[model samples]
Target: MGRLRVASYNVHSCIGIDRRFAPERIAEALLDIDANVVALQELGWHHRGLSNFDQFAYLEKMTGYHVIQGPTKFHARAHYGNAILMREAAHTHQLMDLSWPLHIPRGCILAHTHWKGEPLVVINVHLGLTPWDRRRQLKQLVHEIQSHRNSHVVLMGDFNNWKPASVMFKPLSQLLPECTDQPTFHTRKAHAPLDRIYLSPGLRFDTIKVWHTPITAKASDHLPIVADISF
Candidate 1:
């Protein structure tokens, strides 16, 4: 493939910064990003208000992309999960349960796709909000990435990391050299870099930026970060 655009977004369960629930808004922002690969977080399955609607299906239809969802846990509805969206059909997909003891379960969804006939591994994650729990999640995250077969590894999603220099990411940094420093949370203010993307050495990024717009600022609590990559 030529230069492929990839994006990471936390849809906040399709709820906007205005505190209104609207999946269409999220879809609009996705369309605006127009990325080949999208890593999404906070997608509910059978949530109370969303029991009648299959969010994963709706998003897939909206984007016209294949989706692989990994729900973290089952609660009153669905606590939510991470999903990877591919521009075309995915070659293979797997879900890795990254839940730790006494913590709200979290998971990662890995999708194997091809670009220019070369294998690309995309891992989507929604890490723990707490520092202690996030540390454990990072340890597990490292192992999951290593287990994948593809060498063109691209990892992204809500890391929930407040401190940009958090030591928890040291292990991940070794493999995916680029540090996720772009702020995406609080769309209106854009104060934190909770959402991020990382790419392996083989994949080079031509341009990367947060897709912050008037519509996107209200579409979700977190903005979408897009990167144009070249192999």
Candidate 2:
């Protein structure tokens, strides 16, 4: 058995609570978490003149981690969406579209990697805001996980789940234990459990917490959730 450190953060396009666009601060917050694998949401990639346009490349260089892009929206000169960074290389990875018509684009990154010779499947996602959208998205997500039942799974991201006890999350809870409960949104005085992590059966988490610190509190609108797991 081996342990793996995982983290999930919605960077709000690198715009902090102070209304500042600083990818450096986000990188610093990430360094503080020091997780082995990180799932990021709302990462912005735009042309020059914009704040930290190439956030993906910048964070990868700053944190010295292998970065994988999972953009849900692509523009003429910009892309926006989820991403994953890992200290170890992923054997395989793919972006799964979770976009619903009439709503903004959304997606998840499904990556196959290993920790200490044990195989792992990590799914990084950013669910939609509306309840109907989230319910459908959850159905699709559950189907995907069920297909990969043999592998140890880790699903983490900004679930956009405002109510911790909402029945909409029942399917996911039944499939994988919700690993964290600490509120991680509205960093100013976080009181919403929008950010979360879930683990498949046979995978056990030792400890999990919302990464709260001076830098993290202002790094983005949502704080990062970190967890240590063994399998």
Candidate 3:
């Protein structure tokens, strides 16, 4: 496969730092990134600020990409979680629950798609806040990656890992081996590498950076991280 561009963003429920709920702004940022596949976190459906409309639908329409939603929290009035937007069709997809009991619900979106006729497995996740919760969630994430050891895997998301040297990520470091430690949180003056991308062996990492722009800086709390990879 040739180079494929992928991006991960925490839309923060489409609420910007200015406290505005604008899905269009998020869509605009995604358009600017212009990635083949984008993994998004904190998408809301039927929420108050969103005017009770499905946020994913609006984004799908605006970005013109096929979407697969993995809702972790569901209620009578609201449903929100992670989702994947792909320029190409996904052969199959599923959701893996990573929720810690009594804590906010979390999940990962596992999507199977192709790039230049090669199978690519994309794992998109939004981890919990506490260290213990992230440790347990990472264990499950590693197991999932191991099961798909045969394919080209790209694991990208808001890992919620603030410490670049944290031992909690040791298992992932050993498995994926290559880690991008660029700051993506707090778009105004980012200092934490909370958002990251990991690749399976054999995939060449060409370039990676945080997609920072005027619109992205105000679109959400975290800026989008883009990466280009090939096999």
Candidate 4:
């Protein structure tokens, strides 16, 4: 059995409460978590002031980790999508496009890595807003994960499920053990739990906690979630 620290976060396009875009602030927040592998969503590129810095690359640089970017949308020179930052180099990776119909472009990023000779798979996803879009994308995610049934999987990201029985999470229940299903949305009000971290039975979970960061009150619309596990 081995142990690892993992975290999932949504950077909200690097926008803060002061209505200013600050990638540095997001990086600082992530540093506080000090996770070995982090799956991040809602990262944007090619913004004016952020010209010289790519959000994903900068975070990796600041944290001294290897990064893998899975772009779902390309705008001019800007690429928007999810990313994975790992303490060790990724042994392999895959990106799936879940751009079904009438949905905001959606995708999932899977990065496979070896830490101390142990195998682990980290999935980073940002699901759709509408029910139909969410349901369809979830199906795609299930199919993808099922194909790798033998591996230890850790699923993390912004799910946007305000309701407990939200159809988006229905499929996930079949494969991963439910850890934390709490409200993580609307930083100021904090009424909804949109972020999540799910682990497979093959892994042992030590504890799980939602990061209701103080900066979260003014950082983004949603608070981050952190989960510590062993296997």
Q: What is the C-alpha RMSD of each candidate to the true structure, in Å?
A: 2.0, 2.0, 1.5, 2.3
143-211, model 3: which lDDT tens digit per residue? 989898878899999988887568889888777877688999888899999999888888867999899
Which one wins by lDDT: 1 or 4? 1
Per-residue lDDT tens digits for candidate 2, residues 84-172, read 99998799998899997789888999999876677789999999988988999999999999988878899999988887568988888
Q: State which candidate, 1 or 4, has the greater TM-score.
A: 1
Write down the lDDT of every candidate, Cα atoms only: 0.81, 0.87, 0.87, 0.77
Which pairs of residues collide in model 2? none
What global local distance difference test value does model 2 have?
Answer: 0.87
- Point out the worst 10-residue segment of candidate 3 by lDDT: 44-53
By lDDT, the better pick of 1 and 2 is 2
Instruction: List model 4 lDDT by residue over 31-74, tens digit each.
Output: 88878888888887545335435777777777787889887877
Ranking by TM-score: 3, 2, 1, 4
What is the lDDT for 82 in model 4?
Answer: 89
Worst 10 residues of 4 by lDDT: 44-53
Off by over 4 Å in 4: 46-53
Give the clashing residue pairs of candidate 1, or none.
1-116
Please state the error at residue 90 of candidate 4 in Å: 1.1
Best candidate, TM-score: 3
